[model samples]
Target chain A: MNRLRFAPIPAGLPATVPFTGPETLERRRGAPFRARLGANENGFGPSPKAVEAMARASADVWKYGDPDSHDLREALAAHHVISPANIMLGEGIDGLLGLLVRLVMAPGETVVTSEGAYPTFNYHVAGFDGRLHKVPYRDDAEDLEALIAAGHETGARLIYFANPDNPMGSWLTGERIEAALSHLPDGALLILDEAYAEFAPEAAIPRIDPEDDRVIRFRTFSKAYGMAGARIGYAIGPAELIAGFDRIRNHFGINRTAQIGALAALQDQEWLERTRLKVGKTRDRIAAIAASNGLRALPSATNFVAVDCGQGGDFARRVLAQLAAQGIFARMPGVPPMDRCIRISCGPDHELDAFAEALPVALAGARED
Target chain B: MNRLRFAPIPAGLPATVPFTGPETLERRRGAPFRARLGANENGFGPSPKAVEAMARASADVWKYGDPDSHDLREALAAHHVISPANIMLGEGIDGLLGLLVRLVMAPGETVVTSEGAYPTFNYHVAGFDGRLHKVPYRDDAEDLEALIAAGHETGARLIYFANPDNPMGSWLTGERIEAALSHLPDGALLILDEAYAEFAPEAAIPRIDPEDDRVIRFRTFSKAYGMAGARIGYAIGPAELIAGFDRIRNHFGINRTAQIGALAALQDQEWLERTRLKVGKTRDRIAAIAASNGLRALPSATNFVAVDCGQGGDFARRVLAQLAAQGIFARMPGVPPMDRCIRISCGPDHELDAFAEALPVALAGARED
Candidate 1:
């Protein structure tokens, strides 16, 4: 049979994905993991209010979600002290990243992101045929200055930075992010990913003017609010750029239950704060475990910790594989130096206990290998 | 302040959508409608079992859905008698359509679809910079032969044909679609949208080999399964084409609740059959109401009936507006001849009674104005 052909843009596209979910691993191993800590999901679970709201809205799943997500947008706007028009909700920051890439970068256009930053964003850029210019991270955090320089040097149409960065949870101050924005190329747009913002210190959040068209900040329910599976995230930026999403976005893409659950999650700030405390405690506990194992824990402002394995990326891969083999799911950074550290997500005590129990054995296995 | 620059493709794209959803209409009107028949969403709702599954899964929303969507895919594969490798699920048909257009058609490549069928598909083609060649509908249903001709003439890379099509609710037998496949351009893939397949007669569904690389059939939980708001849909095709989605898709885009709900919905075939019967009854009732109003109801093989207004597009528009004013939401097609009719969705008797009661007055209002 003749094979169906792909367009030139997709013809050379790699089948390689940035990260595979633990569910895939479970399927391959033909067993469920003892604890799910890899994906940085909140095993502490969502607020009771959010769960109830979702249960109530579950039957309404037959009705398409409000295309504008007005109720949720209104709630978010009120939370942010901005107008609803300044915000656009999508299937998650991942989905919004894809749309933002589509909105800002044409085929063959240049985009700049940190070398060790989010691969999903890079995936979107490459998917759109945009040329990526990546600057390596500085001290585990996204190097804003180098990113801006790369953008300027390449005349890049897009630049991205994630605060409290993933894989290695390091963050810079909001003042640093603000100071670096002016260095961006005049025509370039900055995508400030704050997916982990809820767990970050207040000082880490930049108070950018919502009307600032030069930057679009992304936030998600997946991380701090514990609604990753809901696929609800939003972008806050200038009204015009935010509205431009409608031109290409799947208008009814967001589900009704998600809209309701996210709204309830946002409203239950008390639970959010409680989750924050839990995450912080878990972070500290993981750090203590790393110290006991003669490994160093990188400072983190997110829901995960990166433990330096005192080795290289290859060693980290061995440790990760051994951990997975023991049914404890964890991930590590993709690049060198950073890849030397294995990342473990903060979960409930039992999950962390499983990670702690499995780590030493996994480490021994890695050393033996 | 400088405005963020859009990519050349998005820049060239219009800041307009084919259909402004009823939620948007409600927002613009500053009031909610009494009955919603505009979007063709199943008002009868989803299966209780599906809803229960979603509600149960609500607390786990913090964990992102499995990127591979393995379990759901396996279930879908089993149900369809195809390998799990042959299925790919996404946010919805709209999301999948965008990816398909991106995968096959480069800028300026030709694509074919019915002149007035599924505007969202056309929107995607234009958004991706594909040149669309349209063939007019023949007798209210999509003209398969003409679409094939246009596909061959223009060397279109993609051809879209929806069985039990929208706006007009007309259909062609599955055997006819299979016969028409011979006329498709050799390498050009066909997108067989079976969104309303559950309501369609079995004869209208073809027995194409699941492994055939020549075409992809899109199935959605949105219509017959009654889960539009869940935003879950899948495409069935050959392994290679199905695998290609991993190259560019928002891997975690499918919401957790949606995955759970869709799985349960698919499992409960009894509910699906009951809903199909309910839809048939509602369709018949809608047609009867149209006949009583001295309008001609087109032969419908889907969940909605298109009632000819016995006039032109202008009259149909007027009728639609008057219905909106009376808090009854109904829509009409966009193109010329098809726009002469008003499309009403199948709903519970109470909702249909509201539409039925409002139709005559709305028609009178249109005639007067």
Candidate 2:
């Protein structure tokens, strides 16, 4: 009776978050990290025009955002080759994942995902009381065949996959993904999370058939667009399933500045391309640095590179701790095999330089333990 | 199934929203409304300082908000004279309500509220499969005694009452509310949504002991502080219950612009007081306008006034539609007796002047029908 009682799902869950942000580390250490090369965020920042738009909209923040988010959706639709009806924008991909889980997965329903994947999606499934079935990665890539097989076997209402996937920075070609699509079970929605799609090679993004009701694709401004702080991301699917979000989403949850910022960001395709190129350059630099430090960096099509430390999860943890102690913010995958690597995001040159200098010293310090 | 499937909790719920934005109406009508005074937003807008902060942070928009919303929560804690652990911020009260209902209510558990209170909360309860137990309003005011009695009788796990309540704009003294609190079930949590508390008279606010685990208070910057578009609201409660949100909330869901705008908004109490005065003046003008049109305007402690249309829900609906058609947006209650009144928000002189000019013609149009 002393503790406030929670429902069964919440009661069974831990208070731990999926990832610790750099801000949390700063508070704990009482000093800011010299480099923020984790969380796969676009540290190079958003376009100046988008920043100006956000500032202009800031004074008018007292009013509620258009619950419909008409303008941004229209802009996003045009930016991608999709209809606005195919989109359902939310707080972020994290928020959209929560809604998708809620709309499709009833309590005790089954959900399928990789053994070590985006924890937020797993968190959503758990929140909605859906039982999860995880498939292990096949040679560092998400095992699509296993995911489809698991979804069919479990009759999962949801099967989640991140293209140009996080943690391992591995991805499969669009043709392979399209071929794997046939194996998916009917009534089971495939959540193709493409949060890092903009940074991915062209072939990594499939031609999403508008009529495909069984698959929904997600994209975020948080990644290549460099607007994660704006918390805008959207899902693309058939009209009926996409429209289902209207039943439960916080109608006015989209912030006004986010709407304006995202719209402007979408219009600035040049900036997006530049950021993508910069990310590719940074990824190569990170890989080279890892090689010089005797670590193998996994091939990455996204903003972050996963460097294999030739060790286990515990060794990666020690290396991560050592890096944190040296005022560098980095992260590693959770769960086995994948945890043998540390993840570093593409940042501005200075931040990358900081990471370069710290990696060797941190590795030495970690080895001393 | 040809029809799209929904989760059990969301099944059978209407695919309708409580309020439609003017933009949506514009899309339907193919034209925009000229004057906006419907949703009780501050047309006076957010502070210049806030807008500047948001603009400055826009470039950093690619970075995710601190999942913990550490800075804002600490600032809010300082403002409210409580520890950081006592506060939990969400997208808005609307989002928090959804989470709270999910956290506390099991399927079919009873929740008590005024019959025509905020429908968003009701929608959330239904989304979580909670049975909503309603109590009729007493003389346009939330019937607290009945709400408390219903909670005790039905063993309701949660009870909601809004101070300076919405729609009818009626409120009771805080001391009376405090006295009625004893009637609630011992284990039931009382959610006092104080979204309009900033504009309410001093006596309307209860001096609750923050350590009381049984009560949680919801406050928003959306109204008086003019940051509704920012989507920032916080709940104050005992540490145990507040921490429970961490277990399920989209930790980084709050956008960066919102954090910056709200922080600046909080620091400017002077603007808030000015807004209160403006709201008061505008409310009186709305009442005078109602009197000139031969309708009775009810007293209000909130930013909006409910003017009796001398008819039923149908007549008020007609009046509202007529005004909306004429480009003066307004709304009314959805349920009985209270629905006889059309709600008008306080706006700048020009916006209210448009309402003043539009009311009689709209009333006449309603009379003809």
Candidate 3:
């Protein structure tokens, strides 16, 4: 049978996902994992208020969500002390990043990111046929300076920098990020994916003027608010750049329950604080668990910890495979250096206990292999 | 401050939505509407089982939905008698349409659709820089033969045909659509949007093979299943064409609640039959209401009735505006001819009563104007 043809850009593109979901792994393993720590999801879950809001709004699913997401944007505007025009909501930061790339970079234009910063961003860039330039991480954190230099050298249209980076669970200070602004090329836009912002120290999240046209900052209910499955995220940036999103975005793409859930999650600051405390404690516990197995847990400001396997990326792969084999779902980075660590999300005590019990056996298997 | 530049395509693209949502109008009016008969949403509401499923899944929002959407897809596959490989889930038909356009049409490639069939489809085409050829509707129904001719003439890569059409609520028999396939350009792919299929007579739906490479059909929980706010829709076609979706789609875009809700809703086919019967009754009532107002109601298979004001587009706009003034939200088409009618959605008795009460007042106001 003759196959339908793809456009030039997508013609050569592979059908792939950045990370294989634990559900996919569970399907492959023929059993569910004891510890659901692979996808960086908060196992403690969203606030009770959010769950309540979702329940209240569940019946209203017959009605379409407000296409403009007016109320949510207004609320977010008030939260950030910025005009609603500075914000654009999307499926998630991953979704917004795709739109951002589409808005700013034509096919064959350059985009820059750290070697293993966020594979989803790279996926978006590839989707648009943007030439991606990877800059290696500096001491585990996203090497902002090297990224800027690469952007300048390549005449990049956009640069993706995530605060409290994924995979390796490392972060750069807010001051350093602010300081790196001077090194960016004149025309390049900065995509600051602060998906993990709430988990980081306040000092690590710079108070950028929302009016600043050079940068777009993304935040999500998926992370700190523990609503990943809701697929709600927003980007705040210059009014003009933010407006660019409307050119290509699915205006009514966001779901009604998600709008309600995120709003309720945002309103409950007390619950956020409690989740933060819980995450911090769980991170320490995870570190202790790693230490007991002669592994070093890299410091993490986000909801996940990256434990260096004290070997190379290959060894880390074996460790990750062994963990999955033992029904403890964890993910390791794909690239070198960063791949030397296995990433584990902060979950409830029971989930963490499962990881604790499974770690020794996983280590034993890795060693035998 | 300097603004970031948009890519060439988006630079000239307008940020337009298919319709101005009722919320926007309500905001402008400084109050809520008495009845929302616009947007064609199932105001009769989703099944209780679907709501229960959503409520159950509400707390699980902390975990991102299965990127593969394995279970839901498997269920949908079973329901359709197609392999899961023949199905691809997305945020909505709108989102999937965008990805489809991006995948197949390179910049300046030709795409054909009814002039005002679905503005969202045209929006995606424009976003991808596709050259759009629009054929006029013949007697308030999309001119399928004309569309096929235009596709052949222009070497259009895609031809969009929505069964049980929106706006005018007119439809073509499946036999006619099947007969028109022979005239399709060799390489052209047909996009059969079956958004209102359940409301449509089965005879109106073509019996195309699931693996038929010539056409792809879209189905949504948003319409018959009554879960628009959930934003879950799927495309069924040849396995290769369906696989093309993953090349650019937001893999994790579908929300958790939606996946569960749609699955449960699909399982409860009894609610669907009841809703369809309710819609049929409502359509008759709306026709009677239109006749009372000295207007003619177009025969409709979908959840809405198109009431011709026995006037032109200008008169319909006046009627629509007056309806808004009277706190009834009804919509009309934007182009000539079809714009002669105002569309009203099926709703429960109280809402329809509100529309009935407001209709006379709105008509009087329009006549006075």
Candidate 4:
């Protein structure tokens, strides 16, 4: 029963992570899942140029990546038409959220997020001993207005909003976010999690304003750019707020391959466009498959689609387990109403073929159960 | 100035990073360094197998790395002959230090380390608003006894000691470390940073017992493994102490390429041993070069040699700047006494030749200054 002395918050906390990765599950199942679609990772892959760049960079992996991430940050700034000072590159969006939470959330400070939104953000809030206030999703979308209201109600220091959100694949318009910015209370920072922004529609992505102090936007190479394994992401906000990350961030955290790979990915806008189109098609295919099975697939602006199983949480859980039993990996929202639907990520035609073949079988099993 | 609310510590803190990277200096100077030897990176380079492994992993970058880091951790466990439960992987030693500091040192709590020893560790403690008490290096080596005594005096939560220390390239015997562990008072953890352990002599590396609760050991691929840019490191300690990291660490922090690269690197111990021998020879060459110039090279059990300019900090600073002016990027320690010596990493013959060509001229320039 010997234990090392740790901060009270971390000491008392459970060692539960937000998601048990597919690899962990595969080990438990004693077999690899046929489709690597869970976790919302893109299956179409990154730009050939990025893979080439990473392979080229491997020879120089003996040197530490530039700590300032100077070149990558500069490229991101130009790509987004903002000053480099307004950007801070981090390990990933998950890692950046951890830093953002740490920067503003002192012990007992309130942080507001949608109840079933990104759980990693909640993990970080609790890591820093911040009090969490969750506003439930409204009609399957992260209700931005409700999130703002909850932030105000709790006197929260930070509000988490993901445009084209996870699990549900719902989105809010840029106008909705821009108009809502007016009431961002003093002393509160809105963390706009735009990890999947590229897959989201143009209307869902608000204009960039580096001078905007009330909100910070996070974007990653993980989704539409198809570089989730690279672990590269950046935050754009007011220069002062971005500068605050320099106080606590792991300056050398970005991998050398990630830097070069991400830079190449940014340079390949054509590839990004093509991937977006492919994701759109695959998302449609998934919805069609769900419809054929007598399920309703929700509209999606992300690379994933949520299909209502025409059942409650219990039946949805059984369907999900059946999908796993059929060697198809998929996920669902953890909490109530959202859990009544099964989530599937957009994948290549072959993987989608596997899902297509497995869906009816999994559904039949769920119905039998 | 317009600003968002930040935690008290980060709010009051200067937006300073531990190391202003060599690339930042190059940008300011409008040139790249002729000799890439300042950051203690193994310019000897990663194994071709590792490079091949990373290049191979590039196409798979669409998948998030296993959050559990299952295969790599298992390989590392077998490599170190320890149970996997006793290990936790991270971005690097720098990132792990941040997590460790967050886990143990709440605001105002004390942590101890040698002055001018691994500023990044100090940076993490400061980021967490922990009070830091530093004991001056005894004989240009981290004074283990003084550090342990200082822990008692300050009631510090953690004590940091680097084997084959950075900036100065000195080490303490494992027997010395084992003897000191007896007095590591309850509630205090000793962070035994052996980042350069692979390059150190056999006697210097202590046998690790994962059941030991008094200390945690950190190792990185950035040192002798020659994968500095890959950003993979791991901590080993009692299962309980290691589990604490799961509560705060970025679960998916380890990059996919880094995992595969490190695993490939571990499987190629021949490459590691070859790098170690090359480093030893390079260290000898660097020492020989210093001796030929009438300077003294400090005893080293590392990939780098710290050469005394036979003067004070001011003279060494001049030598460092002169090297910079000559496009030779060398670094000196930050505090006095240790500051009298300049550090040079072991690189290829050509880079050391550039250093050889520049050292005497730089020394002459320093003498004149």
Candidate 5:
């Protein structure tokens, strides 16, 4: 039998996933997690309007979604006060990141990011056979200076920076990001992932020009709008760069129900604000729970809080495992310093109560270990 | 502003989409299509069970879909009497095709396909900088022998062939495809797009070994399953090849509602059989309508009927425009010889009635042109 010939890049890569889903873990553990807090999904749920829209659209799934995503794009453009041409909707931030990497980073070209930034972004870079230059996080936040330096040193084509950082839930002021933009390497494009933008303080939201060629900002319904399963996100960039996505993107890839749901979600700012309040309260509840358990919760602007176990990475791992064994699903950062914390997403009160109940037992188990 | 540096492949490509969706056309025309038939979507709709499942799943869209798509894959595997490892689900066939091209076709590598075959597949090839070797259709059907011959000549890495061919609604017997398998070029893999397979005659549905290394069969919920808007599809191939998708695919790309909806759709085979019966009736109704309008409807093993306008490509195009002007959405083949016909999808009786009402007027208008 002839060997199945794969392109050199994929063939050389390992068959690995960025993250193992909680569902897979549940199957393995032979029980479901009582409190689903892993993956940073917005457990406050999508807008009631969005859910209604999706449900209503369910029967209409016979028709293909508009390949142009015209209405949704128009609404998003209006919401962002940008031209429709400046926005490109995709399956998710993950899908759009893949396209962005493919468009700019040729094989062996370099990209720079903090060591423990988004693994999915790293996965896309590897998938495209792009070399990654990593910089360590500074004070548990993505170090913009270090990243820019690495980009300059490596002559990288792209630099990825996520604000309201995952795993640690640390953030920088928008002014800081705006100031750092001018320091970007000459040829490198900055990929600003604002997946948690809705949860951040207004001061943390950058005010970059939509036509800015140096950066492309990605936002998702998955995090704040609570539509992760809908698989929809959009990137705001220069018109030309946005148009470039059409050259390679799957034109009709967006799900019809998702498009409708997202559009409705965008229109319901009241629901979004309500969700923010719920998330804010949940964040506090989580922090209080951590305090009770003798662990410190890092200040968080996003829906998830990274609670410092006050121990090293190994201790945090043990705590996370114990939490899982106690029917609580949570994740910790993979790299050092950040891995001293286990990330927990804000959910409804009952789920938080479950987490509150589970943390002490988990910490005790980890201490015993 | 430094010009955005795109990788060589995309930089050289035109910003063109595979198809201008019906919605885009409606926007341009300042009117909605009375009958949405142009995209070959299932107008009969998904199973009620599937619709209910999707609607119920809407509230849970706050969580990311199981990246593994375990339950759906398991059901599909059981239904096909194959191992789950043989199946890989994607956003849609379009998304999977893009991944497949990226996985195998290196820059400037050759791929073979029928000239006017699924344009999305060709779009992906061009996106990846793969050279496409086109073979002309034989009697309005994809020339399998010629495609294999071109593959051999070009030492192509992939050959894309669709069963129950689109645009012309032509198909070859499964036995013929089984015979052609042995004739594939040494290194080329066959991309057997069975998107229309459920609507095809039983004899046209190929029964190739699931472990056949040379062929990967793509099936979609978009067509007969009535879930085009849901964006779910699957590919059946050798286990190793199926596993290769994990190396690059967006793990959480599938919509949560779509996964649940598709699983339910798969379970409701009775609904699918009923849809097939309805499509058969609709095909005959379209043919009868064509006959009344003094046109010939080609024999179709799929949901849509290709009605020869008894004119050339230009005249057929004019007729299509006239139908569109009358708020009827229909499409014709893009290439010559086959372009003498306009394709109409199987829709509800009222939609077919709208088409029947518009056809004679369209024919007269085209004659005047």
Candidate 6:
């Protein structure tokens, strides 16, 4: 019984879990959902001055946080004008994409992304054994010139991409991600993510050159600073790739009440423009509840929407198993023609009136199976 | 300017930080230190029901936390009677020692540890290029048979130790770490680090076999459950090495108000036995203010003490720079005769009366240099 060995890339990995938490499907449906609207979080919360600075930093949680998250990286380098050595803060954006795939991918290198993007950055490029490369999603976003020609045909030292996209809440604009930075690939690096850069459309946020060592970006007090369970996030690059994430991070891996609740949710950018007008009117009431259940919704800039579900992916997995048999958690897109779409998220209108009363009885129980 | 490359073990490491925190020396001493007692944190706080469950989970910080921190790992597996599949939790114990040195360190493997004990586990075994070794401190504790004879003379593969030790808060008897696990090294493993297992000494806690795949332990809601800025911790072991930390943790890196303030600071074990009788009366008032400044103190079971300062390590680095020129933040020990001591920590008598009124003016300004 002498097992305990492991390190051949986590013994050829496989424990996986890049997203499942709806409290493990309400502890396997012992109740509790009635529409949480799957993980793209920001359930319309966070900046009541970042929940009063995380209840005044929870009685100073016995102190250790400032592992140089120095006043939240000097208030995120004066709110992104940059240069707190181009900010780093972590433990989110899925721990800064597993420290930017352990500081630039090395094990069997190459990375790219897109095909059903952000499976936690392909579970941190297969927990660092790297060599990923997908790049499909062309019409429904994230296909920046086929991920810069699959990072110039796989010389890929990391690419990723995201920008207002996630399970089909497509986008692009910031001058087409600054004109796909002259088709990247000469020493790769891109990443970008922008975890729904505050529900997009500030011209979809491009203006790069934070010392552009090709791109890094990230961003995320978990979507529109609603503080996704306050894990914190940040990246913005090039101060030598954000000081090469202090040569391997976890320096007090964040969380002092999520660095004073993400510095009172970045000094309340007026509660992030009132959570971007409540996620643009809950993304137009989830596209008028997917056009009263006939479905179609898709054109989102973020805060989650998707919809489609007219057919395929086995009728959107039987309309997400009849919206989890009416309790409703909702999620979709795991490849295949974008899993005929479902997604959801933009919460709070009584959880979008319990997802508009569980979407026409989950589309007539997925059209009577 | 092409430089964003890295990954050859973070480009041969170096941008280090294995502890420099006291808010970067109070922002390079522009003040603010009247005794924070360096990084052995827990200034005796935390469970007012985990600061009322982190101010009632700060308005449910928009979901995301339960990335399966499933009710604080089923209340730390019923407070360690074990088997929540032998637990894991993380983002602290310096991020589960950088995901247990990236799931058992491969590149040039090796490991061991002790010399300067926890420099964040030798900055994650030199950020995963591993090959560490160290093995020194014997009388000041942690030598565990020269770290199991340097893990059977460098066949190493992770060793680490730490029981009630750190710097020089010496300890040993959990039946001398369960009789030094029959001199380990079979497949190696060990790790241990019971982050001051609640100010140690329940016979220095050592009844192993939680399916001992040789060992694992860890612990910490940041020491004596005070919650070190709520980074959380955990570990335990065996269930297939605690499910090889989901093959590479950061599963939404826990922090829903630190998993509801560490499950209300682990169901308040009477405020962790009243923070171990206020860190055993502030470790006997820091060994009676290091014997009224003549200086000696050492023998501690955690919550910090050290002291020593009779000589060398340049008179304990001139009495830790005259206790940081009077603001008194205090900390020492980095190899050598445990750097002729200095440490301190156990606080709350008005921060140890500002470290007993700046220790005889920092030992008369380090005996006039």
- What TM-score would chain B receive for each of the candidates shown? 0.98, 0.97, 0.98, 0.98, 0.99, 0.36
TM-score of chain A of 2: 0.98
Model 2, residue B22: displacement in angstroms? 1.7
- Per-candidate iRMS values, in order, are 1.8, 1.8, 1.7, 1.9, 1.3, 17.2
Residue range A1-369, candidate 2, lDDT tens digits: 432689888888888887788898899999999988878888989987888888777777767888888998898888777899999999999999999898877889999999999999999998888999999998998999899999889988889999989888899999888998877888688889999988888899888686687789998988888888888989999998888898888898999878888888889999988998898899999999999999999999899999999999988989999988888899998978989999999999999888889889889888999
Give the range of the ten consecutive residues with the poorest summed lDDT in model 5 chain B: B1-10
Under CAPRI classification, how is model 4 graded? medium
TM-scores of all models?
0.98, 0.97, 0.99, 0.99, 0.99, 0.35
lDDT of 5: 0.92
DockQ of each: 0.71, 0.71, 0.73, 0.73, 0.80, 0.29
Query: How many steric clashes between backbone atoms does each model show?
Result: 1, 7, 0, 0, 0, 0
For candidate 2, the C-alpha RMSD (Å) to the true structure equals: 1.6
Q: lDDT winner among the candidates?
A: 5
Q: What lDDT is reached at residue B46 by model 3?
A: 94
Please state the Cα-based DockQ of model 5 relative to the true two-chain complex.
0.80
True contacts kept of each: 0.83, 0.80, 0.79, 0.83, 0.85, 0.84
> Which portions of model 5 miss their true places by more than 4 Å?
A1-3, B1-3
Q: Write the per-residue lDDT of candidate 5 for residues B135-235, one digit (tens) a residue.
A: 99999899999999999999999999999898788999999999999999889999999999999989998888999998999999999999999999999
Q: Identify the CAPRI category of the predicted complex in candidate 1.
A: medium
Give the chain B TM-score achieved by candidate 3: 0.98
- Residue A261 in candidate 2 has what lDDT? 86
Query: Can you tell me the CAPRI class of model 3?
Result: medium
